[model samples]
Target: MPYIKKDFIERLIDRVDIVDVIGARLTLKRSGSSYMCCCPFHNEKTPSFSVSQQKQFYNCFGCHKSGNVLGFIMDYDQLSFPEAVEQLAKEAGVQVEYEESAGHAPEKKEREVDFYDILERAALLFEAELPRHPEALKYLHDRGLSDDTLRRYHVGFAPESWDYLIKNLAGDNQKILKAMTDLGLVNQGQQGKVYDTFRNRVIIPIRDKRGRTIAFGGRVLDNSKPKYINSRESPVYKKGHELFNLDAIRNLRDKNLPYIMITEGYMDVIALEQAGIHNAVASLGTATTPEQMNLLFKQADRIIFCYDGDAAGRNAAWHALNTALPALSDDKQLQFCFLPPEHDPDTLVRSQGAKAMLDYLEHAESLPEYIIATLRNQYNVDDEGGRINCIDRAAEILSLMPDAILTRAAVEKRLADLVGWSQEGLHGSIDDSIEKLRARKAVRGPESTGAGGSGSRMDPNTIPLNPMRAVVARLVKDPELMRAIPEPDKLVAVLREYANDRCQVLLDLMGKIKANPDTTTGALLEKYRDSGKIGDLISLLAARSDAAIEEEGFVEIKIIDLMHYIKAILQEHLTARKQALRIKGRREGGLSNEELIEVQFLETATRQLQPSRKS
Candidate 1:
C-alpha cells in the first residue's frame, strides 16, 4: 500500500469541524470559549469534558483527557488511527491522498488499485445478466417484488456457464484477474485455472456502511441444503462485519429512532424496504457479530430482531440475541418479532401488505419479556423444583445483559413475587450463578465502544486509584510538556508503579515525543491507541484528576518543578533497593553477580541523574 502523506492528514484535520464530529456522539453545550459535556470516558454526574473550538482541542477539568478531533473519535468509536482519519476525512468530504515512499514494500494486491471499481462493475454485470434470465426474473416477480423495488435494490442474476463472467469482465489483465480472485468472485481449481464463483443463481450485492459493494450473496434456483451462498471473507469484506441492505438503511438511519429492525436474509431486508420500513437491514448470510452490532448501535438507539416463526427462526433469534447480549449498553434496547409458522419476511410481506408487517414490528416483544416468556416455556414452573430450575436458567441468560437491563434488586423482587421464593434467598442464589457466568465470559473480549471498549458490565471499583495522578494527567493532557522535564527516563521509572495498566505505553510515548519534537498530542495518542490499555488508562487517569495547568505557555514551568520531584523520588527508590539487596547478600553468603551488578548500576545511574535537579 502507498504511504499516506502527512500533508494530507494535516489538511484533513484542518478541514473538519471538531464540534460536529464530537457532537454526533454526544450533546455538547456551548460555553464561553469551549463546549462541555459529561465525559463519556468515565462515570461522572457533573460535566467536565470541555472542547475548545478556538484552539482545536479538548481538555476535561475532571479527567484531564485532552486531544483534537481525531483523538475524540478514537476514544468515542474505538477506532484505530488510520480508521479514524479515513472516517473523519470522509465526513469532511476530502479525498485521502497517498504517495509511495522510497524502498517501501507493496501490498500483495497493491497493484490492483481499483477494488471498489471492480466490485461495482461485477454488480452491474449481474444486473445486465438478470434481464436475459427470464426464470430468475420470474422468481423475483412471483415473490411480489415490484420492478421499482428490483431496480432500487440492484438485484441481479448469474448464468450457469462456467466462464461467462471470466470471459465478459476479466480479459487478459493479470491484475484484474488477481482482483477478482481476491474478492472470491473467481475460484481457482486444481489446474491453477479460474472459474466463476456464482453461477445459475440470483445475485444480491452485500455492502459496507459506506454503501460500497464489498461482497455478494447468491441464492440457488433449485432446492439445495444451503439455499444461499455468500462471498468468502476477503480483504474488504467479512460476513460478520457487514449487513445486507445496510447501505440502503444507513442514509435513512436516525439515531433518535427507538430501534432498527434486523432481519436474517437479503430478501427479508429488501421486503422490509419495499414495505416502506427504511430502518431495516439483514446480516450477510451469517450470524450477527458483535462488530456488526456495534456498527448498528452507532446508527440507532435500539435493535429489533425479526426472525421466522419456525423452530429454525427461533434458534436464529436466540443465537443472535446471545451473541449481542454482552455488547448491549444500558441505554440501548433489543426486541423480537416473529412471523407465522413457515412464513418469512418476504412471504409475510407479500401475503399481507406492508401495514400488517409494520403492526408486528410495532408490537414486537422486548428482550426482558421474551426472556421471561421463553424461560417459562423451557421449564415447568408449576412445582418448587421446576421454579428453581427456571430461575437458574434465567440467571445464566440474564447475566449476559448489563445491570441496565435487569438489576439484581429488580430480579430478586420480581422473581420472589412471581416464583414464590424468598427475595433474599433468590437474590443470593442468582448472584452466585451470574458471577459464574461473568467468570466464564471474562475472556470473550470487550465491546467496540468507550475507553475499555470491552462492553462488559462496568463497575466503578475496577478503575484503579492514581497515586501520581497529577504527573500522569499532565502527560496525557499536555504531552509536549514531557520534553520540558530534564529527567523523563527517571520520571517514567518512578511513575511506572502507579500506572498498573500498560505502563510501557507511557515509556514509549515519552520516547516518541522526544524523537519528534513537533508531534501533536492527538497524533501521539493515535500511535499507541491499539498497543494495549494505553488510551483507556490515560482516559481513566484523566478522569481521576482535574487538569491543573492545561494552558499552553504555563505548562512547561510546572513540568520543570514536577520533574525534579519525580527524579528525587527515583533516587530514593534506587538507594533503598540497593541497601536492601546489600543487606540480603550479607545475610545469606555474599552478593550474587546479578544482584551486585544491579546495585552498582542503580547507584551510578542515580548519581548521573542527580546533578540536573531543579533545586
Candidate 2:
C-alpha cells in the first residue's frame, strides 16, 4: 500500500475503543471515569498511566508519555505509524484503503521510496554538516534552541558551497541528479549546470503527517536579500496542504484543546514548541489556505490564528478569514490573535515566556468579534448610510457561514444590535442575501451548499426551563441517562434555540455523553473542572442527588420526562415563530420566498413534535 487514506484511518479509529485496546494489553483497573495501570514504559509502584475512555486517550503522568490509541500502540508495540494503523484496522475489522491499488502500487512505491530516501539522506548530510559550521551552530544556540530541540526537529546547515548537496548526494549519477533536481534539493542553472538549492543556510526539513521528510526550508544566516528559501513544490510536497511540525503536534493526547495556535512560519512553531507549547503549527510561510484550515479543523474543533499586530498582518489575517468562511460551522470555532507591533510568536515567547504567549492566545478575538470590529473600524455606524453598508457587508459574510440555525442566529443578533435594526427586519434582509449568494454561485458553477437551520427564540420564554436545567443536572449525576434522550440532534437544535450560556454548556455536555456510551459522572465532572463550572455542577448534583437516591432508576425516568418537555417546548416555539411569520407577511405586504418555505418547515416540525409522551 502506498499510504493509508486519511478518512479510512479516521473511521477505523472511531470504531475502536481505547479501553478495549489498552485493557487487552495491560490490566486496567477502573479509576473514576478512567482506567489506571502501572505505565509499561516506566517503572513505578503507583499507577500513573491513566486511560480516559471518554477522550479515547492515555497519559502516563510518571513518564510524561501521553497520546491517543494509535500513539499508545506505536509506543507500546514498537511499531511505525503505518504499522499501528494497520494493527488497529485489523482489530476493527475494516478494510484499509490506500492511495494506490496493488496493481499500480509498485511504481508509485518505488517513486515514494526514492523521493523519501533522497530527502532523508539530504537531511542527514545537512545534520552532519551543522557541527562543522560554527556560525550556524551559534545562531541557533543564541536563539535559545537547545541541543535536544535542534536534534528533535532535525535542524541542519547547508554549507555555503553551491555544489555541496549535488557533489555529496548526487555525484555523477544522472538519475540521482535528476531525482535531486526534482526534489528541489538541487537546481539546474544556465547551460545545464546544477548546484545545491539551499546553499549556506539553516535547513529545517518539513515532514508529512506520516513523519516522512518531504521538503526543506532554509533561512539565511545574515542580512541576505531573500531571508528565506523554501523547496519548490514537488510531487511529494504541496505547500497549501501542509503545516510545519504537524507530524509532531498530532501526537498530542489533548489535541482537543479549546483552540490550536496557528503561526506564520517554521521558527515560530519551533520556538513555541521549545517554550513548552506543543499545540501550535505554522502555515508554511504563506497566507493560511482553505485546505490548511480544513486540515486544522480535522485535528481540533477550534483554531486561533496568530500574527503581528501590524497592517500587513491584519491584511494577511483578513485574507485567512475570508478563505475560512465556507468551512464555518456551529461545532467549530475560529479566533485571531494580533501580537504587539514589535514581535512575532518567536520573539514574544522568547521575551516574555510561554505563559505570556498562551495568555495572548487564550484571549484572542473571536470570529464574530473580529468581523464586527473590522466593520466598525471601516464604517461609521452612527451614520445611516454607513450602518446600511455595515449591514450589507455583514450579511454577505454571515451568509457564507454554514446555514446552522443557532450560530447564524447568534451572529445575526449581534449584527442587529450593532446596526440598530429589529431582529425581524434583519432576518428578512439576511434571507434575501442568502438567496443572492446562492444565485451567484449557481451562475458560476456547482459548489457545496451548507446545512441550514432556523434561529431566534420565543419572546416571553425564559431559557433553561426548569426541565432543561434539571435534565442537565440529573445527567451529571448519572451520565448513562444521556442515552435515554431521543432524537439527540433535535434535542440539540432545541437547546440551541435559547442560545443561553447554560444552554451552550448543556449542548456540549449532551454531545460528550452521546459520543461515549460509557461516560461516567466523574469523567464528566473532570472535563468541566477547568471550565469554571465545577462548583456549579457539584452543587447541582448535591441538590438533586437525594431524589435519585430516594427512588431507583429515577434519573433515567426523569431524563425521559424532561426530554419530552423540552421537545414540547420546541413545538410551541416553532408554532409561535410560524405565526409570527404569517403576521409579518400580512403586515409587510407578503413574506419573501425563503420565509414562506421556513413557515412551512416550522409547521411540519411543530406538527411532528406534537406531544407523544405516554403519560
Candidate 3:
C-alpha cells in the first residue's frame, strides 16, 4: 500500500469540516460546540454519537465508537484507510500527496482512481445493453423479476460479442485498456490482446455501502459449465470484502431490520429483493468469509444465512459457522436456515412466497444448535468414548467465542446441555482450551523502544487506576494541555522513577508534544497509526479521559493530581532507602562515610518532599 504523507493527511483533516462531512450522510443537530445523533455504528433510540466541532473528533457514548473524520468515513462507509483518505480529500477539495516508498510506483494511485471510473462506466454500458438484448430480459422476467427490481439493482446484460466492452469502453485508448485490464474488466492475453471479461451474461453490478460500483457479477442465460463469473480481485474490489445489495440495506430508513440474510449468489439476492424481502445479501459467489460476517453484523445484530438444503449447501453453511466463531459476541448473533433440497432462496421464495421463506428464517438454528447438531451427526453421543470426543471438540469450538464473559457463558451452557455434562465441568474444560488457544496465539517479536511503533512493550498495570495513564490519555486527546504542567522536565524525571515501559511511552509522547506544540489529537494519533498494542492502549486510555474530564479546568486538576501522586511515591521511596541504610549502619557498628552521606541526602530530600511530616 502507498503511504499517504503525514503532513498531507494532517492538512486534509484540518481543512475538512467534520460537520459537513458527516452531515451529508446523517442528520446532525447541534449541541453546543458538538453535534449529536444516534450512532450509525449501532441501533439506538436516544442520541449518543457526539461530534466535537472544536476537537474535530467524534465519540459515541452508546457504542463507544470514536475517531476523527477519517475513521468515521472508514467505519460508516465501509472503506479502507487509503480509500477513506482519498474520498475525504475529494470532498475537502484537496489533492492527496503520498510519500515516496520503495516497491510502489506512482502510477498505482492513478490506476486506482481510474478503476472506480471505469467500473462505473462499465456498469452504465451494461445497463444500456440490457434493453437491447431481449433474451437476457426474457431470462430475468421469467425468473419473476419486476421491471422496478431490475432497474433498482442496475441489472444489465453483457453483449455476446467478445470485443463488445473493449470497443465501447477502451476503443483505441491503450491507457484505458490497461486500466480496465487491471480492474478485471478485460483480460490481456499472451500477445497483449484484450477482450471483454463478461460476455452474453446478465450483469448485476456489486457495490459498496457508499453506492460506488466496485465490481460486477455476471450470470449465464442458459445451462453453462460455470454458471457465473464475478470480477477478479483488483485494487478496488476484494471477493470476500463486500456483500451484494448491502448498499441498499444500509440505506433503508428503518435502521432496525430484525436480521440480515446471507445467500450464496447474486441472483438469490436479486430474487429475494423482488419478493419484497429487502434485508438480504449474497457472499459474492464464495463461502461466507470472516470479513463478510463483520460487514453483516455491522448492519444488524443478528445474521441469518439462508442456504439450500443439499449436501453442498450444508457444507457451505458449516464453513460459514466456523468463519463466524471467532467473531461471536453478546450483541452479535448467527443463525442458519436451510431451504428444501430441491430449491434455493430464489426458487423457494418464488414457489412458496416471501412469508413462507421468512417463516423458515424465523425458525433458523442458532450457532450453538448448529454446532451441536453437526457434532452429533459426526459422533455417537450414546457411547462413552464418543461422548468424550464430543466434549473435547465442543470445548475447542466454544473457546473461539471472544467475549470471556456474557456471550461465552450463554454458549457454554448450551454446549454443556448438549453433551449431558454439568456446566461446571464444561466450564473447566473450555477454560483450559481458552488458555491453550491464548498460548498458541502469543507471538514473539523484536521489542520496540518507541511508543509510536509496533512491538512496543506495554505494561498491563498501566491501565485502570494508573494516574500516569490518565495523564498520558489527557495529553494524547489534547496535546495543548502539556503547557499546564509547572516543569515538564521535572515531571518526566519523577515519572521515570517508576522505570516501566509506560513511563517510557509518556516520556516519548512529552518530547513529541514539546517539539510540536501545535499538534492536534488526530495528528498525534496518526503518528502511531501502526503502533500495534501500545497504540491501542493509549487510545483506550484517551477515551476514558474524554469521558471523565468534561468540566472546565478539571483536566488541569487531573494533571496536577498525577504530579502530586508521583511526588508522594518518589518521597516514600527516598524514606524507605534512608531507613534501609540506617539499619545497615546499626547492624555493622558504623557505616562508611559515603553511606552516611547518602542517608543524609535521602533525609533532606524526604523532608523537602513532605514538610507536613517534618518535626
Every model's TM-score: 0.77, 0.59, 0.86
Runs in model 3 lying further than 4 Å from the true structure? 17-35, 100-113, 189-193, 403-407, 433-462, 489-502, 545-548, 553-556, 566-607, 611-615
Error of 2 at 594 (Å): 52
lDDT of 1 by residue, 1-615 (tens): 566667687767656668888888789998755689987654468998887664466666654556668877765655656777788988888777866555454662375458888889999999888989999999888887888988897889989978877887788877788888988899999999789999999998887766788889999877875788889998788788777776665565433455789988888888878887778888877888988887777666678999988888888888888888876665567889988887888788878988989899988987766777677777778888999899888788768766645533544566677677788888788889988878887799653565535344233224654324445555655666766776666566554743334345556666777776655545544455555565666555433333345443565567765575455556666677778888998899888898889878878967975865576
Ten-residue stretch with the least lDDT total in model 2: 449-458
| Candidate 3, backbone clash total | 0
Q: Please list the C-alpha lDDT of all candidates, in the order they appear.
A: 0.73, 0.75, 0.78
Give me the displacement of residue 324 in model 2, in angstroms.
2.1
* Residue runs of model 2 more than 4 Å from their true location after superposition: 1-113, 254-256, 448-615
User: What residue pairs are clashing in model 1?
Assistant: 63-542, 63-543, 446-454, 447-454, 447-455
Per-residue lDDT over 430-547 for candidate 3, one digit per residue giving the tens place of the 0 to 100 score: 7887677667666764334233211112333345755556567767777877887778887677556534444677778888899888776666666666777667766555555343
> Over the stretch 1-615, how does candidate 2's per-residue lDDT look in tens digits?
377776676666667888999898889999866799997654468997888776565666554455567767766654556778888888788877888767768866546438788899999999999999999999999899999999999999998899988888878887788889888888887888888899889999999866889999999888886999899999788899789977776665233355688888999989988999988889877788877776676566688999999999999888998888777665678899999999999999999999999899888998878887898898898999998888888888877776764667877888888888899999999888778877877877755211100111112112344545656666665566667776778668755763444466667777878877675543454345334444344323422323343345465567766667566556656777788899999999999999999888887888787855796
Between 2 and 3, whose lDDT is larger?
A: 3
lDDT of 2: 0.75
Candidates by TM-score, descending order: 3, 1, 2
